[model samples]
Target: MGERAYNFGAGPAMMPDAVIERVAREWQDFRGEGYSAMELGHRSEHFADILARAKADLRALLDVPESHHILFLHGGATPHFAMVPLNLAQPGESADYIHTGYWSDKAMAEASALVNVRIAASAADSEFDRVPDRAGWQLDPAAAYVHICSNETIGGVEYDGDPDTGNVPLVADMSSNILSRPIDVARYGLIYAGAQKNIGPAGLAIVIVRDDLLERVRAGVPSVMKYARHVEWDSMYNTPAAFAIWVAGLVFEHVRKAGGVTEMARISVEKAQKIYAAIDASSLYINRIQPASRSRMNVPFFLREPRLEQRFLDGARRRGLLNLKGHRATGGMRASLYNAMPLAGAQALADYMTEFERKNG
Candidate 1:
């Protein structure tokens, strides 16, 4: 096996070396069962224990309260965009949506088809360069719930504080940046994240929902769309994504042993700061997002001389830094420094940036 480069892909991104190595060894046999974790039956006792431990570890890491239920769902956070409105919003009833960036807007579009969606706040006017001030929000008194993308993976904006929605409960799609920091579960009615980013792999989404919100689903929605159904069945209403769930469980255990969310938050800040500081110090690079709202998980920056972009990217790859490529839609460069990206990797990128500028600037 080759040395893993400093991977900065946005999703299905880097995972801890230890987790990868351990999983590599266990892929041959798990817990003396003489079969890989992937081959194990989801309904078997071995997998069941693994599933339970994953849930417990995630709960402990997030400090999820007993009043909330966590589910390992099959679809990515994309499906939850529709499911959230289906379960939470009755037909003709409105829901408040904060439009911050691409994902948030996509979610609002899905919800708008099902229910009246009020634009409580939007960063559209600023070209999505900054998160809208909380004081600028115009929440609807009669809305089913207020929704926000706690972090925008594309635009790289993030919320600095808990959103205040008054009587209306908050629903958040924390897909890209979930578990990169500590979150107070009590602050939101529902928080869902696709497993591809900070969690495990694709095909599994972790939904943390308050029990009360689960009970408030109006009838006539699809049974599968109901959060209550999953809660009642322990997220196994039908056959689950067994492999993804098992891997997600291992990731949960890994995060817990590494000292939970608080430590993760600290490491995340340190890692982000290293890159952001480098960007800030360099005349050759610039991060457009407002400093206060800049994402600690994804750092998007641009070269002062746009013409040298290819040279920069090609050189990065040649230097053993992979996937530092920016999203085509929003071109330049985006280094997604998720939890699994170590401090050394960030420093390596910083060093690369400095040397690249010294030569190219």
Candidate 2:
């Protein structure tokens, strides 16, 4: 604890200490080999084995079915905003998008360029402080697919559970909360996540897509963007992000050892409750989001007395609580307690909040 600080950045965030230590030890000569993981060719036998082990671990952890294909892709989830439409939505056909937060808005914007777009549901009227009820979604009967951002990082809203979108295939961007809880992979036609929050480092994204979706690719979609091509070539259609995928695999193993997603979900709820209770009890701070729709992964709050914002951040930093500042657009303090953040860290932050209120109130 001497040098380590509680990190709360939204993405490219904290990683498990066990993973970091192991990487440091074996980075130079992985598995008794002479070359570092970064220097090895993507096609080398050693790297191939590393990737296979990773995918195997992931498939086991998430309970992914044999009917689904897993791919380690290059671009972040940002690119899939456009790629999803290009592959699934033909020019005349429309796609349904749920506008839950900033990310969903961006996803719809990208989709609009390629196909007819329909906003099936939106929380814009609420300023994204809460998730709209599932019953309120305005679904289209003839859309190509239904897309939703499973968790909205910037707006501090998350779906408590998956939604049933009728016979329409559901596509989800679960970037911030992928392994934070258990998910039924069979329910989704496609699940994509940028591996920086609960998974691993940046430069890698994990996509679990159903086998039927492969044949539906609209012609002329970029080869690099097509899910079919990646599945056909085993995500080796081009040079993969070797090191990032390796780290993701290691993270998958770590989650499995910790008792898989069900256990992770239990811990996630406990961690969130610890901090949320402190926020609610304190007269000096307020979290605007609805408790039921609140995000367990990212908690955004504001001091009752705005003048103490700087003091609160500075004092927390001195105490080794770091990166608790909110998103600039939102203008408040956000504590992003991802999977790597221990319950002890949340309790520590809660203690610091009590102390700060005592002094400043």
Candidate 3:
């Protein structure tokens, strides 16, 4: 049998081998139901149980408070960029945004069309190498919410702790680091993430909106984009993503049995530290983000000699290390150490980085 290669893609990244194996066993005849999970009716009692269990397990995993409703929506995190303002703010009202990197920029661009998007703080002058200090942020007291990308997948900068927004709602797009560690759910008004990273496959987005925030949906917003409508229907206002939800349920179960997010964080810290230590020791590579702000999930580093980039990637692929390329906007290398990435995988990559430097640099 061929071995599975370590995957380091930023999104739709990787899944636990146990989860993948369980899917194989259920693919043709799911739990003796005589049909594939993909073909099950979303409204059927069978699927209802699946949906309910998924929600229960996720809530247990994250310690999601009863005040926040979790909704499984269709589009990825991009849709929430617009939905956040549409549901939370009135026409012409301001919403504060913390500009950290590429994903943060995209969120503001879409939100600008819906409300008076305000750049409360930005790290643009540093080329997004670090998140702006929260104390320097010029927040709007009248703003609907304060937005921040908890983890900048492209630049590899992540907030170590949630910023205090005082009375204003603190909204975060946690697409890249949602389940990697434990979080204080009561601290935020809303949190949304695309399922492709730590949750499941490509077809779902998870929205955790505080119940009171649902009552703030602006007039004339479509039911599809309205948070309250989905909350009323329990994420089944329309058909839910049945297959993805099923898989996510298994993932939630797997993570819970694996000691939940607390254990995941310990392992994540070790994995990222291995790679970052290798980069720091080598003169041939560099990661520009400030050390304190560096991400434990995505490690984006660069080879000192740009000419050797292609050769480095080619050599890594030969060793069963895959998807090491960085985002196209910024050319270099990125290694996403999601929850599924084993510590051995990170150690392997770190070892390769050292050997590659010895040979080429």
Candidate 4:
């Protein structure tokens, strides 16, 4: 029971203190039942209630419409890269993709193996410093759907708002930024997020899909890969991730009590601004992404002296900040300011940055 570090890892990120405390309190016997949530069978009545409440709370927080289905599926966003193309596009039909950064590029690469994938827009020319402007997108009129990684966890680029995709369905891989802001659920045809970032833990992903898209799933696709199967079975086609779902349910409830997505968005902006401002004001650090497209959830910055990268991380750890190292592909520091990272944590990180710079600058 030592004090927890201010975690800054990209996924399996921080959870609210309140949620963690609650989970600890109920670990042995959930709601007076004689078994832990992890021990309960997925099909048990108690587990069913947990699943229902989790979905209901999430729907309320996101304002998901009745026309849409909320599914808690196993596997993270990587699976969806393949599943999306298999379910949505026909043999000859292509899907459009906006390649903003690493994750988006990965998505396109995976989908290209299964179906026709058209690069409607890409920010590779700029080293993914910003999202390509909507006006610059060369979208196909006959594309089955348009896919975008709303936020790039590695490159730290994010779309400020929803892209206008015209009649085609807009699908977003919102893994890092989902529930960090208020989004109009109806605007996107499909949105999926791995639970590790803003939701709960690893091993579960939440998929929100519009009803009409279920009808378009390729007939030969495996039942497990079909959105319709998950929807029909209430996301429990087989044994679900019971413990992860229960924890996620607790998180959803916590979010509601904390004033929902609007409040989360407000705090997210505040946290990101604090860190970005510290980086901008310093001669010792740099955030390469354009201001407009900077991610509120993941802030990747580089030290002026790359040699000090390890020292910076070591110092951060000793100061009670942890997981501040950047991704291997992008060698620098990345502070993921997810919803669970309080304003105080961001401020602490800023203070550490300032002090560290003064000593080493």
lDDT of each: 0.88, 0.88, 0.93, 0.93
lDDT score at residue 89, model 4, on the 0-100 scale: 89
Per residue, candidate 3 scores C-alpha lDDT tens digits across 45-129 of: 8888988998998899899999998889998899999999999999999999999999999999999999999999999999888
Q: What value does the lDDT take at residue 187 in candidate 3?
A: 86
Misplaced by over 4 Å in model 1 are none
C-alpha displacement of 116 in model 3, angstroms?
Answer: 0.8
- Residue 125 CA error for candidate 2 (Å)? 1.2
Give the range where candidate 1 is weakest over 10 consecutive residues by summed lDDT. Answer: 214-223
Give lDDT tens digits, candidate 1, residues 132-153.
Answer: 8999999988899999999999
Give candidate 1's TM-score: 0.97
Comparison by lDDT, 2 against 4, better one: 4
Candidate 4: pairs in clash: none
Per-candidate TM equals 0.97, 0.97, 0.98, 0.98
Estimate the TM-score for candidate 4. 0.98
Candidate 4 error regions (>4 Å): none
Tens-digit lDDT track for model 4 on 31-86? 78877856877878888899999999999999999989999999988899988988
